[model samples]
Target: MDIVWFPLHITLFICSVTAAASEAALAKPNCSSHCGVLTEIPYPFGIGAGCYLDHWFQIICDRTASPPKAFLNVIGLEVLEISVEGTLKVTSPITFSNCSNKPLGLQAPNLEGSPFVFSQKNRFSSISCGGIALMTSLYGSTIGGCLSICDNTNTRVLQPNSCSGMKCCQTTIPLHLSAFNTSFGAVLNADSQMACKFAFLVDHDWFTSNSTNISAISEMDSVPIVLEWSLLDYTNFEIYGTNNWTDDKITNCSSHCFCSKGFQGNPYLLDGCQVPSSVLGQLFLLFGGWWSHKVVRKRKHIKRKKKFLKQNGGLLLEQQLSSGAVNVDKIRLFNSKELEKATDGFNADRILGKGGQGTVYKGMLTDGRIVAVKKSKIVDRGEVGQFINEIVILSQISQGNVVKLLGCCLETEVPLLVYEFILNGTLSEYIHHQNEELPLTWEMRLRIAIQVAGALSYLHSAASSPIFHRDIKSSNILLDEKYTAKVADFGTSRSMSIDRTHVTTKVQRTFGYLDPD
Candidate 1:
């Protein structure tokens, strides 16, 4: 009887220890893993002090609201779901319309100082008898549109999960797009009998749930919009030992990491992410370690691309192209993969030159066209507006002496500009490089100078808008294979109205090229 009692007590002790461990693993020390109905407010996002990574990720749990509502700090958007895959779903109020065409438009949500960005998965959509809506970014770039047309005679047939531009229409926004201005097109008095016009950004998934009836969406006060968030500064290689997550450790850190590849859980926990026993065997045995690592790397690469897209104003660029502001036929938007492959993964051997702004790489596109890719060194928030403006200004340039901006890649941390590769290199290289076997002849130098001068003249007066090439130096002038001079490097360039005689701006130029004034 004594031996049996001893075994029973040992079993009870082991079971108690395991239970405690499980509870501790679920959440960080002194931090609640849940808030009211939201039972899974993971690390990096928390409802209480010491639980969240920072003030930007704080969730305000409003208990007064019936059933309790979770709101992201300052933004005040109602949180519907939080995904560890760097995405969240939130609800936005919509204007309701009964019979009269109620002006239905909501100001875009401002997402400054937060890691959150509007996902491409959310579309600018509308439901109305006949209404045209426009979606523009904070900088006044039109991103997308939703136009719904209807007739008073015909009975409307609504299709679920589809916006075919009849009674309902939808258009896509860019990955990092956040704020937007949505306004309905003015209707003629004849169409005053139209029912209502409703337009707002919405999650793609929500369309399938209740998309059968267009009226159902209009009747509802709010619609769901999907947003993406991430730890942009964190790397995939960072890892920690088992079960060591404490409130004090990651309270201020903005990033968290999973235990290993294929593991799915809160990355902030020591043992949070783990392969389940059920599928772990099959995954490891069939795919092996290399395949698992590859998959994990791919996911990390995708997240990085999304981060770059947001930082570089990808949405605005897309909007410009889609809205016909920029001609896509003449200018292309390259993704990270394309540019990487083009430049041999940006190897040192492929480097063309380096400047204070960034590096240029010699690349070959899939079409066998050799190009120069200018990758910026940094992305200043204040400079983003100017960067977009430059793209617009360059796209309009068709002068023969100006280096053609073939396209750009906004899907990077800093925007990259692609130009027609000048094989002979810059004018400075030919004139200053000691290794140059053939020096420029007097005639060639005079011709090059004339070409550059003509290019500047075209930019200043002949163009639709006046452009000021503030930094006009020998280094900024390139030479094609034919040794014809082509004006390049518009990084410091500015544009003004055709009538403006001069514009006031901070002086920015290379050494030995500054205006004395």
Candidate 2:
């Protein structure tokens, strides 16, 4: 009886092994699993026409190449590695400076409207003795960059794995980056006669670990960049609907799909993820469910924040600040939560003043510093540009007579500007509605007038660019604690080059404050 039962048990075990092998297929049935040297062309990313999940995932196998190379069909990027963990490593081209025989201008691959985005794990790097590289978004906004300058000794030696703005420089790329362009400033020293400058986004880990000799980077034409891929809609893939294999439990599916606890393989294929055979493995899955759920929630929250940041021009602001284009040292990019908490959800009681541009609210920051927050009323595309322009202008102005632009918050629907909270009211309040506590004497009035004139002189002549304050008025001027006048509200200000005499524009001024000239 024992011998008979042993044969029956062996038969059952053989059947189970066969079933597992059939279920754990890496690709669709009858489809090519490997292309040339790439042995791991899993499902959703296949070689043949009907094999791939979509056009974006189609891999074109170039058999004519020396070793047979696989390329991502749509983007034409050379495929280096594909991981089921939602990452694809590809060889991306370098943007060479115009000084080189290589094609001029940035040649960054366009990934817009595709399922792939440049992963944050990549860094924007520049290889040159004396060059300033800039990474700009598809919308023409500067996003990331680095300035590499040679030492005074004019030596070609660069420290291994060091990119600290000398000989070689590196900076971080923003989140949700799909497409970008690279540009370089004029050569720092033409007599240096160094090799041509080039910039590219490269996988940070690979670059640091492998590229020990940083000086040799100029000889390379392309670098490995990691791209994160995701299915915009997971419903396009096959769903698991079996015991202990529900869509949400066995296959964690969101914008992207992944095998659940105790499973390992492609979640995009039917029963692609292999199930646990041992009871201990199954028990591990049960305990891991809570942690997995927590991780998913955290990831979703982070993704949402990234989306908001990109939409609110945070990347552009970051680039400007990092590139040293904005000379001010105190300009900060405040987050939405910080500004919201400071203003108590923008309570009406904290209203400082209301204007055609926006409303101002008085608040105290976490650092116990008093600040006046300016929240724009409406935020159309035009308004957003104007808001950014105002930030740029204020950031460049360092005049003592001008209201100091402490920082700005762009994460909100409308951008918010923070300034040093003026203890006293506007000049209009003092002139029209006299303050009983602090009366404006004739001597004080003369001093305020002189300060205002000096601020105007600075704006028109001393400032980096000549600025025209189209809507200057008594209400736009603020008095500090010591009665020092500050020229504020540069929302309608326009900057022009010194060569230009005047700029034509539609009239933008307060009703009674129009220039008589």
Candidate 3:
């Protein structure tokens, strides 16, 4: 009799567990979980007043529309998506310029005293021929902005899916950003009949995935932006009139809240997060193995980066900069991933030029700044010290005619150097391959020569250390949009102490331009 009873009791317990798991709640009892069109409005967000966790989570379902669209009542923005992952997607209006026929005011949403903040996944974007867009906080503080410029041509041909400061430009927003105002400066060539200029904050991923053509974007009234949501007090179960969840049931409870291991769904709702009885043990093992693998990979990646940093003379450069009077902040150490993304995985199309030392690629940084990245060929380990010294010397030299070294990336097998992007090509290109439309005039040539001589003089005598440009030719000189000369390519240059008159070194010069000395 005892054996039979034990078997029956075990069966009953299993049945009960399965029944409880199937009853996992998505929203408050007797509350609508979703509105028309949007079917996945998870808990923490509800359609009725008492259904939601708080006022901030209230969703007002407007039945006047054809499909009865849902809107976030607190912010009054149309809700596109609400995920348990603590993100809310909504449609935001675009701010048009005064010259545009559309409305001429800013769309500044006030999210103060709420749990929502603009996520970093959104980008501040602007569209104009030559205009500057600015984003400011509620307190009238400048947040960030970008400038978009284009040529004065009737047929403005913009590249499809590219926003590298042409007719369209994009920049990143600060973290924990809640509210902001968008305004535009004076447009360069404002035309009422032309496409109207506008600015807005949009989801970066969505914008990149969609057709970024001016016509397509101009047709749209609004764009989707993501907002990160978090609960200030998760332990306040009294506010919800429930005491079902304990501290052990939730994890990552600092700013954002998540279910513990083996649990799923909204952590803010009672019984909203649960695991099936049959797959409970399997999920535990799976999560454990995944977490372990992630940890191992992260550690390995960090170790590899540290090894590369030391090997590429990063440590030596730090020591030299600390010992000298040069400002260490002038030169930045960039990670390899950043440059890779900026250059679209270093695509072949981005190649600006190639030389014996390395190849130069045109890339746009996250801040909308155009830059030139130089990926060098493999170097001997013996020359690591010299490379570090050159970087130190370059950081100290500040001349208008010299190409500015913005930063370097030592994490790659071949080190990369970043410099300010020059709009025009090298002097050699202009001299060799002339353009009929924009020919190099004699006056421009004379001005370039004078600028080059001034740059060389600065390098030789004006700098803190006497430097010699072993290779100085037309190909080594770059021109800006205004035809100003910018001396470049310091790979073959050397620096000497102030006390020394001259130092002998191996001659490194281009053929047909060698000095007779």
Candidate 4:
């Protein structure tokens, strides 16, 4: 007993305790590991509110550009493509030699002012016809280039979008291109029989025969160009640590998607889209594949949604004749088209109110019943689909406080629940906006609260199956001109078996009045 345990064992036990404590104190990563699938609202590319840092990270959508360019704010750098691992394939514009009346030879364009620097790993990719393409840089630094090609008069040729020596001579400039003027010159060789000359930087893969074959002077002019850009002399680790973060990390992009800089891929073996370097690809991009992946996913998503609808009691609903004491036939089945007519395609003016569950619209039925319709935009959400529960709950109790369920329409893309229209505003409007607490009096607030509590107490205790009004916020409690309270918006309520007082479900009740448990 006096000797105690071994010294090494005691030391190990203490170390284990310290490690556990450290882990308990560790802070969670501030950012979300991945944005929702199909939703590309990445951290830097967020919606209205406080989603982004500032203007520097603006994702300017240029519909004017071919294929519509997406620029990253005031930096002036054009984003060619973004990857999941937080890397972007960008084009570094190089100043090619400017063609002029002067007799001077070729020189590198003025690339010194360019924010982007050329790297040995990148290429210049140029298309030419009849004339020489050259780039002249500052400080007397120069790089020269010459090109030649055949006429497109050959009958065996496919004159579509091609530029192979027959009419267009395609080539690449040396690495690390920056700042130079653009210019075109004649080679003055046997190929010099051509009248006009044309040249421009183009994506090696994007260059085509059309640039050369379709020209009036029979020379290539403006070719689609792509400049590969990366940080200079960065090790694998340093390249990944690019501090100039513009937008947030993109977890998901178009299919076969990878992350640009500032992100890494999923740590696991290629599960979701990520921005990892080693576990993910370094330089493997197929533009065609990336483009087509979206179409494939869109089709798949539509299928999944249909499947979810059928799974969530959609088929059971079609079975008809729910004999749970409630008059189930009172509820009508509405198609997406039917609801569009009823609410005028969910017109803004018809909107009564909006909540976490969905949008509420005012619609006039064919029989002239002006009803309030709650539409479930989130088809997968279980909250708005509890039509059966409401029908069951309403059938048992005949009460003045609870709003009557006029019925529901479920055959639509979104389930539309119809309730008796309460002409007066909500209790919140009286309490907050109109300062009803002052005008309506303290006795009115107490009476309204008591009225709401009584309605909920009845639902929770008296119904055949004990019902819990999961959402009980003041807004859900409506008030008539007579000051009588009528409980409304029981979107997330539960009707449990009398034997079992509570039921388990995916929690989607609104905040401020959510279940304590």
Instruction: Encode model 3's per-residue lDDT on 1-517: one tens digit a residue.
Output: 5445654755665664553342234566667766777766666788776777778888999989988899998789999888777898899988886544567685957787798999899999998778888998777778899988866664666565567887889999998888899977766666632556789999887887755554477767788899988876555573346565465676886666788898776676765666634645645554576568778988998888888888888778777877874557898888898999999999999999998778999999999999999987647767665556557667878999999999989877777889999999899999999889779899989999899888888888898887787778899899998889998888767777899875766768586553222
Candidate 3 accuracy as lDDT: 0.79
lDDT (0-100) at residue 454 of candidate 3? 88
Off by over 4 Å in 3: 1-24, 99-101, 153-156, 188-195, 211-214, 233-235, 238-247, 276-517
lDDT of 1: 0.72
True-structure Cα RMSD, model 2: 34.9
RMSD of each: 34.6, 34.9, 32.2, 21.0
- Please report, in order, the local distance difference test score of every candidate based on alpha carbons: 0.72, 0.78, 0.79, 0.53
Question: What are the TM-scores, per candidate, against the unseen true structure?
Answer: 0.44, 0.46, 0.47, 0.37
Candidate 2 structure quality by residue, lDDT tens digits, 368-407 = 9999999988656545666666777888888888998998
> How well is each residue in 245-357 modelled by candidate 1, as lDDT tens digits?
44322223354233445544566655466554443454345345545666798899899888878778777777867866565778777887899999999999999999877
The collision pairs in model 1 are none
Instruction: Pick the winner on lDDT between candidates 2 and 4.
Output: 2
